[model samples]
Target: MSEKPLESFVGVVGKETWWSRIEALEAAAAEGRRCGWAARQRHAIELTIARLLRAPARAPNAAESEIVHLAGLLAASFRGLAAKGKAALHASLHAALSGDGALTPIFHQMRVAERHRRRGFSVSFAGLETGAAFDLAISRNGARAEIVCDVLSAEDGREVSRQAWRQLADRVDPDLHAWLAAHPGRYLLKMTLPQGLRADGGGENASPAHLQARIRTLLAGDARAQQDETAVLRLDPLVLAGTDTSQHGLLAQLRGDFGPEAHLSVTVAGQGVFVMAARAAREDDVGTALRRRLAALSGARLSGAAPGVLAMFLEDTDLAEWRGLRETLRLEGAARGFLAGAEARPVAAVSCATRAELIGLPVPQSAAGGEVRFANPAHPAARSPELAAAIRSAE
Candidate 1:
């Protein structure tokens, strides 16, 4: 080979690298801050694929640590896709894994590990497809292992999805529902918009009618619109209100539910479930405890325009005591300002024996008081399978 020909080829190869496309995508995504999560994730997937292809070309045999890290990253990205509801990517990944011998099992393994909240995995790569002329083999610990491109972190992906939902809530200003309740005179909605009308207006130009329209659209889209709308009407303690009408899965898994020293967590639904953990000394004590627990259980952050249903789980032995306690607690809640609206707070208090009993609890027979009503949660398990499994495992 002539030295001149070899030098020209080296320059051409260096100039036309695969990473340039990824760089352009990254820059464009950065330029558009308001771009949706779906757009951002597409760029991420492409960038990751470019990086993976580069890895095999630079060195076919990568360190186990390097492979693990890469695999973990890719797994996270896959999770991000899942979180975004991008079924196409999932289908593609499965198709790629099953049909093409270009990728290894490490991608699937890493995804499994992330789902289970594991740190490391034993990985091997049989073939790494780069679309180049040569087929590459990746090894770990003197064995064949392939490390393909990784996606986002599974945990991070969840956070991203959460943030997206939060953004959507903020854009429509769901908190304004509480504000509207407080200042009804400020923005009067004299004309009622048609049902199924969603809010589209924003800024100072937007009237109260527009805001109401938006709230209506958002609530209507929600599966639990009726319940949430009721809670929004009584939004005095805005910070303590349960904004998230979505299922909480198991309340027991979260450490933030209890005090730092306490190791107890009750697996309540997202709407919130309050267990009569320890009996109170006096009639007044249960009210005090209920208030404190309600505040603790319903996080300060408002996810929507609703107060979480504060259900009290009770055993057969405590029925009579709880019956008397319920009235006293309800009275105390009203007096103490924990319960509000035409609906009685205590009336809404659902009594159940166990989590299983909570699954198919019927609606209260009598609409006796303006008490908050409790019903069976639409979804008992968490949104993510891994998280749902963890909750079940804890139980």
Candidate 2:
């Protein structure tokens, strides 16, 4: 290994051994001079490497934690493909760089694979090479287990998606700034999306455009509140009796104030401030989405020849919602329920990891001990000590 940390890291990324593929990944990002999530991730990794090249070796600081985790993740993920799984690598890198949230599934697969490997299993991307529906193959002793990795979004069970809320927020930013300027006072806009908010709205009232129009009407008119079948919008004094200025501190406060399930954003102009918060009439059922996804992928991805592991990654979740699911046993209930269903016959184990595990947070910050996994006791291989490390439940 090179004494230079950057050189060492780059080497681990196979910058020398896998330069052609690296160029291919870069080429995919370079099409028409395009830049997206993958491009940004690439840039971030390169920037971190550059920083590593200049900085002296010392104890890892909080700032370097992201770099360390990112490097480890990429290094482990990329090396698994090597020169043999070009198609899989191409597909993954393309999706991730296209900024389409492909990183969730790809990283989920790698993260799970890493966990199994650390538990003493020899892991392979057989599915990637063979074009199988599943994503990974892990072997321990004389037994092997096939894993089908899938990702489920938390928005699936909601009447109003977070993505839609984000689009609405962006669309309303200019209008909100103007409204703040005209009003010149702090305000809070609380909305209840009963019929639900959608980005396209499918040519209906649920669309962000429709919502924007409603907000515009509220801001321009004398009415302090508006309600209809689709939504309820209320404008009130922005009374955020709170204090915090450090990074993510205000956000922490805001999330604490609004709770995890609400879609929240704040816009400030000159001396005026505006806070927009919205939620569905009911709570989101992320578990229902997970169970549905399990049913959808069960037969299609599992071969049923060997004990199968369905590794699920739940995305678009916040710290609060994530914790609530576990504390409330919502996640375990969902997974165990699926394990009892007919579709779970081929599955010897079901493991779930959330966004925190995706980002590689350490213990205490991550799920205590490790990922929350459940073993199917009915499966013949579930009790094998050799396979226990891979198929057994941690919960």
lDDT of 2 at 42: 34
Q: Which digits, one per residue and each the tens of the lDDT, describe model 1 over residues 280-393?
A: 111223344444443443343112222122333321112233344444445244323443432222121222221112122232321132122332123232232322222221
Where does candidate 2 have its weakest 10-residue lDDT segment?
31-40
Q: Any residue pairs clashing in model 2, and if so which?
A: 38-97
What TM-score would each prediction reach against the true structure? 0.23, 0.79
List the global CA lDDT of all models. 0.30, 0.72
Give the count of colliding residue pairs in each prediction.
Answer: 21, 1
Name the best candidate (by lDDT): 2
Runs of candidate 1 with Cα error greater than 4 angstroms are: 1-126, 129-164, 174-214, 217-225, 228-234, 239-395
* Candidate 1 TM-score, C-alpha based: 0.23
